[model samples]
Target: MSTVVYLDRISKAYEKKIAVKDLSLQIDSGVMFGLLGPNGAGKTSSIRMMIGITMPDSGTVNLFGQPFTRESLKRVGYLPEERGLYKKMKVMDQLVFMGELRGLDPAVAGRRAHDWCERLQILDAVQKKTEELSKGMQQKIQFIATLLHDPELIIMDEPFSGLDPVNATLLQDTLIDLKKAGKAILFSTHRMDQVEKLCDAICLINGGQAVLAGGMREIKSRYERNRVLLNFEGDNSFLQHPAIADYKDYGGQAEIQLKPHANAQDLLREAVQKATIYKFELVEPSLEEIFIRTVGEKVDA
Candidate 1:
């Protein structure tokens, strides 16, 4: 795949504080890439530099095989983390205005905005003032605006915020559709479950740098500890099976850590023999766990 966006040695700072330092990454075309981190980990700063909202103090941002330029804005859609919408303006009007800002003509923008409103299931709210809509509705509206111009790259920050499950699923489906249409997407979010479900690749940012980055499957495989989760209904004493060396109880299930060469199936066999096993499966570390392990507990300034 071709590189859609590339950041080479990118660095950003505000006054005496560094936001991003020596950050480098290449986003492949047509992949749903996630930028994940804690609140002040520079995810937003890195995204800002990519979209030309802020220039890097040092380093290069290349968009679509060329230096980042004003023209590239036309091919990119940005849904910022900080929500911004004209309070008094109608939903349709706001979307149209945003499309125009993306260089689309009024007629085309209006047409596309209408289509987007319908697709997002918010056509009925088109005439309502931005402030009149519920938080989830407003989020959907902004999401529509981001894609109104039909850009090739969609960059989003906290795209799931203020959204209910139904609406969030709608947005997720829409993203999948966009991916099928060959759009490259970069999103920053704290919703690890959503990231695990949606992203093809991810970059874990920490302390102004990437602590971990790679394809979802590859990263998970690399972090696999050959652990197993088990649930049994019979005697609880069976959990004391000698085969399991490390265990952490999580509700009804136990996260059992197997020995270095201990076969997962062997452990399961022992577990079943000792108790009536209700559930037993090998598991991979969650993204949250990986993030904490890789980034550590030190808070960045």
Candidate 2:
């Protein structure tokens, strides 16, 4: 796939504080790229620079293989972390207006907005004022507005915020379909589980710099599968095995963290000897674990 967005050593600052520092990453068509970071870690700064909402103090921003320009932004759709909507306007009207601002015909915009609302299960709210809708419903409206113009690149900041499980799944499946249709999607969210599920590649930032960047599988493969889940009855003395650094025992089930470079086989052998093992499996470190390991802090998500 062709590169849809590219940032070359981008840097940004406000007053004495550096918001983003020498960050470089690229997004390709049909790929879902996760721009992940802790709060105030420059994720918004980098995204703002990408769509010309703000400019980087150093390095370059490229969209569609060329220098950034306002004209090129027409092909980009951005849904910021802070929601913006005309509260008094009807939901459908607000969506159509947004579509028109992006160069869509008024009629085409209306039709698209209707179809989107139906697909997202918000058709009933289309005639209601934006102010009358629930936060989750309003979020879905903004999501529809983002895609109304059929932009080639979609950037969403906390797109799933305020969404219920059912609504969140609806949007997730929509994004998957969009990616299959060749749209390049870049989203920044605190939801590591969602990122792990949706993103093909990711750039993890901390302190305004990239701490980790690469394809999801490649990055995960770099970390050892040192976690173990065991379910057994009888004696639980295996939890004291030397190979295990720590573990939580819940009577018949245990979640274990193996010591660095420790042999999991040794732990398993010990467990079998002490208890009747029903299950023993070595699991890869989850994305959240990797995040805490790299960032040295637990994610609030």
Candidate 3:
């Protein structure tokens, strides 16, 4: 796959604060890359630099494998966190207008807008004024607008912010399909669960620097599968086994955290002897657990 976006040691700062520091990552075609962080973790700052909304103080930004240029931006589509729709305009008109700004002919823009609205199950809202729609509907409109011109690189910041579960899942499926069609998608979100499910690779930022970055499986592999979930019918005394570090018991079930390099097999053997073990499974650290461990704080998500 071709590299769609590249940031080489990019750094940016305001008068006194560094917004991003020596951050670097690349997104390749047909890949879904998540730029994750807490609020004010420089995710937005890094995105702005990627799309030329703001210039970096040091290092380079490359698009489609060449130096950044206005021409390159035509191949990019950006959906910012904040909504920017013209509230009075009809949905179709607004989407067509956005497509035109991206160099699509008016007729082609109108056609694509209608097709996308139909595909997204929002055809009935095409003639509705933007301000008349609900927040989720408006968000979907913005999403459609972002893709109307068929850009190769799609950047979305908190794209699922106001969406309901069903709509969010719809958009998620859409993004997966886009990735399959060879679009390079870069989304910044606080939703680790969503990232774990959708992203092929990720760059997690904290305090203006990457705290964890890699393919999902590779990153998860770095941490131990020291957590265990148990279900039993009898004695809960086995929870005190030497291999266990800490655990929470809820009557017949327990969620356990093992001590570093603890032997899970020993704990399982003990658990079985004390109780009729219905289930005993050792699990890897979840993405959220790794995030908190790396960032040293709970995620707002």
Clash totals in order: 0, 0, 0
Top candidate when judged by lDDT against the true structure: 2
How do these models rank on TM-score, best leading?
2, 3, 1
Write candidate 3's Cα lDDT for 1-301 as tens digits. Answer: 9999999999999999999999999999999999988789999999999999899999999999999998999999899998899999999999989999989999999999999998889999999999999999999999999998899999999999999999999999999999999999999988989999999999999889988899999999998999999899999999988888899999999999999999999998888889999999999998888888888853432
Model 1 earns a TM-score of 0.92
**275 in model 2: Cα distance from truth in Å?**
2.5
Model 2, residue 125: C-alpha shift (Å): 1.3
Error of 3 at 37 (Å): 1.6
Flag clash pairs in model 2: none
**For model 2, the run of ten residues with the poorest summed lDDT:** 292-301
What lDDT does candidate 2 reach at residue 11? Answer: 97
lDDT of each: 0.87, 0.94, 0.93
In angstroms, the error of model 2 at 247 is 1.3
Give the per-residue lDDT digits (tens) of candidate 2, residues 17-65. Answer: 9999999999999999999988999999999999998989999999999
> How do the residues 148-170 of candidate 1 rate in per-residue lDDT, one tens digit apiece?
88888899999999999999999
Ranking by lDDT: 2, 3, 1
- Among the numbered candidates, top TM-score falls to 2
lDDT of 2 at 7: 96
